[model samples]
Target chain A: MAAQTGESASTVLVCGEVRTCLLPTTQALDRRGAAQLLRLRADMYVRVSERPIMHVLSPETLTGVDCRLPASDGSRTRAVGTVIGRAALTEGRLLQTTSYFGLPAVGPDTRRPWGQYLVRPGIVEPFGMLPRKATAAGVLQGARRGELDTGTIAEGLAAQLCRHELLDRRAPFASAPTRLRWVALRTGGDRPAALTNFTLAEDGLRTVKLRLPPDVPASAAAGLCEDLALHDWLLTHVQRMLDDHPFDRADDSRSLAALRPAVTHLLHLWMPRAHVDGALAHLWDTLEAAPGFTRQWQNLVQRIRDQLTLLDLAQCRRAASSKGCEE
Target chain B: MPERVFRESTAEPRTRAVPLAHLSLELGHLYMEDFQLGPKRLGEHFAEVRIWADAVRARAARRVKRPRISTCFLIDDYFTRFSTPDEVIPTVLEEAGRAGLTIDYLARESGCAVADGVALAESVAHRLVESPPPGSYGFRPPASRTGWLTNGSRSPASPPRTDRGRTDWEPPVETAARNHSIFMDVELWSDDKNGQRVWSCSFLAAVWQLARLGLLRHLGEPVLVPREQDVAALPPDWDRLPPLIKVSATKAAFSAYRTCTLVPHHFLPVENAVRLVLDQVDVDTAALAQVAKRSADEGMPVPPEVAQRATYVFYEEPGDPIEDGKH
Candidate 1:
């Protein structure tokens, strides 16, 4: 696998995007159905684990691309090779598709035949020397037309899985899916993997940039991002579930009714770093230190619980008053 | 790190290895029109294909020591079934024999769609990774809406309704163009009269290419596995024949590192579509790794790309004397 493609061809830059959403099934697929749904290839294993959640990760697949590198400095560098897309099911309630690839610092000047890239699965080799920093910024900033955008490839798989007949097409709630685009630049200099910048881009796009130890597997970086993305998605959903509701302004019970799904489907899914490889667990510490993921999550959790308590008290008062009037 | 805390046994991947050949030479393909044109047309088709098949064998020999080669033919029992195996198999074998060509494996086209209870076509459809044109920008292309696979960016379609947009014509652009665009979009499947999904000829051809290239698999098992049938006599019906019948005692594996199909000129577009579909597919990673390791160890390293492994020689279709009679 390209992940172990030696130090010389060791990833100079590792970047990926993950799309997370509630699986569009009226009822979330059970462990059995989740395993079946993620069987993208029969020859590959659909890894199912019950350690944390009934999680299922489909065998990783590759998509070949030969297009302009999405460079922030707008250098017209062309990259050629495959991008890896893996579908993951968390507790059979949420589906996340992550499309990712690593870049070597330099590659052949000309595009090799496609088989050359297939053997190297997820390695997207750039023509000539790769400007690692600029390329990383460019990808994180965004891709223009014809640029190699890993997020689009990720979205393609997510959309495809959502359309399967196995799904009832009726999501439990009408919530926008979140896109988390992450780029990890190899910190060749002595620096343990550190989360650099995590930006919440417009339209549910979250971009996380990391400086990782060169020796860490690119997949470990992706796993870290997926963990961050899943928790981030949970926060986003809960925030939306309580947005501008007149919980304090009115005696209406609709706000409480709307927030109930948040308690049921999402509250328990904030287990950040649950599936993240232990080696990369320290990266979550960086997140917790600054814009603390758990800090904001706990705040949101407290607010929701407080609101629910208020609603319950109001409902009891209203019932008691109504009964006395009727007597 | 004296002791490990916890480990889940299920989160592992394993790829079963399949036997491989240096080359898979497709003798030719027969469709309803070819079958309707009858045995004489079939004879002429094989005669034209025989020359190309010999050339491919020679090329394979030059590349590798004792290059294992397998020859196969596909019969279109999917799109429009004209005759049964009882009527068709004997003549096909006889014609190929007269042309001094041997088809080690005889496969039904429908088998590419569904063989031995596996939805192989649907599996491949899930694998279609589109060649992203410049400026893809994370926008998931609407492949689901059209069921079409294109080689490059399509002309901006006339907005679905008049109220939504104005009529402005845009030229379709090929992503890999040098000076001019030869953009092609292939429709892989459509609904029939009864609303049952029908896999298109081009899509099935793409799956056939994957099978020949030794890329198609379902659940760690080889797909379209050749079933040896002693040809005492042809089966009573088309359904009676095994999806893939091994007609020869040849030792070469049916799947190979590379494929060369002797298709008629009319199939050029279909094969082109196959290229588009194959280009985007991220084939199973573990399986891909095995192929790469096996080939490298064998000292006959194959191209890493699934699409590049496929080759085609399109000849003029044999004119139907029956059509001449109609004229």
Candidate 2:
């Protein structure tokens, strides 16, 4: 038998994609509004966390998948199960949708009854033995024709939420949505979860690789990746705002107008590892040390603050000079 | 340590677990035609179902030492309303009693669509996640939008080749077919003359099956809760009848870990459509897990797939000797 016929709790691989974008609303939503907006399932409650930040999470939903597993070495492996997806809104400003599924090393040769798969949500079992490393690499690199595509699922969910009546569909700024494709391979419990690689590809696509402890579930790994995605997006977005050179104008008034949304909407959303599982939270330390997500964010934030200060001084001087002329 | 452990009710949702039996055996379905044929026809139907019910009980006994099995009867009040519940209930119960069968639960088919103000059918419809076709890279419009759920890839929308160079005809192919295909596309719902969405019989059947499997939940609460009203108090109006009533004195639960249905041979097409719909529904995972855990604790683990957990016996329709001969 190519695949085993019973339940297996240990996950061999986890693959996911996260799509992050500013909530397309003129005004940020309050806790109550956020709840209404993220109500994806009428029968399930939308989780709202008040402390740390106003983070709202929609109930996990499943999308059934019965397709070829993406293998970088070009091997054809069929997998059948459901991929789980959930939408999260941070501080009612940033919206993110994550689509993910864990894979076991082996599965039954034929697709079992759908009810069996339904019971094990977010698990996509492959026929026979799973090519773990190649599949992981395949997820990060990209899916081929007829291969499972988590990015599209994530993007589709984000689009669906954006189209919700609660949202005005009018973003405060013109910024592209960021896509983070991630893969986590199981490692022994002796080794704690660690971030192995982070790559920023073209066209808003970022990839992260991690070695997660067996005890840490795929959902935790997904949570860690989502945190990384949100922070990285904040840095990228603010850097682009800095590049726009709102201060290039003769007077900094226009610059202040241009940057108000960032100060109002995006800056405070940079709290990293806030809601991530403690077991996998330390993975952020590696990114903080090297590329320094916090360091870059702090710099942009200071620059924005200085610009606001400079803008204030200019206005004061102009008022003083006008008063002198009147005397 | 902080003095307070903050909590949000929405954040920590709970699923109310339903008491589960080892098997929920459906005795038979009553339709308007069967009612018009009178009590003798109902007696004959129950007699045929009695033989299969015994077989189902024997099968359940093999799985567990002491199997808790419940029998349910569904009366068709949705598609075509017949006599009032007051008239229908007594006669149906008497016939089943004559055949030495006891129906623990009596349910109306309309109850599957909407039970106690909960739109069970629409909620289940929203939960439908279409099985991805071979080349379903992702983000195809949901199958629910077209009001049809299919098991395979439908032929392309393009018509036959023409002078203008349109594409040629293609055949629909089932996703899991080995040698050949038996493609099925079942309609989930359609608009009525008044433009109100009418849930299809097959779709409601799928919902009924999910309820029997103890999988339907509304806002983390159990749906289709059987009212403990006395059967003798059944109302003259079908509208006033409870969706489900505990008719028997036995303590067996209405829902179960698995279900075995004894239906008539002519209803085979409808049941097959039910399977097609059930295969695609993404049921509440928490409820599914509860059943899995409870069943495992009892030393009778169910198959993972919701559809696989259901078994059926398609006997010839009672008093249809000519139809049996033709077959």
* Every prediction: chain A TM-score: 0.94, 0.95
| lDDT values, one for every candidate | 0.80, 0.85
Measure candidate 1: CA RMSD: 6.5
Candidate 2 stretches greater than 4 Å from native:
A1-9, A74-78, A107-116, A246-249, B1-5, B62-65, B157-169, B320-327
lDDT of 1 at A105: 89
TM-score, candidate 2, is 0.92
Best by lDDT: 2
Model 1 TM-score, all chains together? 0.76
RMSD of each: 6.5, 4.0
Model 1's DockQ score: 0.25
Q: How many clashes show up per model?
A: 22, 8
- Report the Cα lDDT for residue A194, model 2: 86
- Quality of model 1 by C-alpha lDDT: 0.80
Give the top-scoring candidate (TM-score).
2
Put down candidate 1 lDDT per residue, A1-327, tens digits, no spaces. Answer: 232344323678988999999999888788889988998766456888887767788877766677788888879888887787889999889899999889988999875544456556678888999988889888888788878888788988898899888999998888888898989888765777788888888899999988878777787788888888888888888887777566767555687678878887888777888888677887889889888889999999999999888888888999999998999
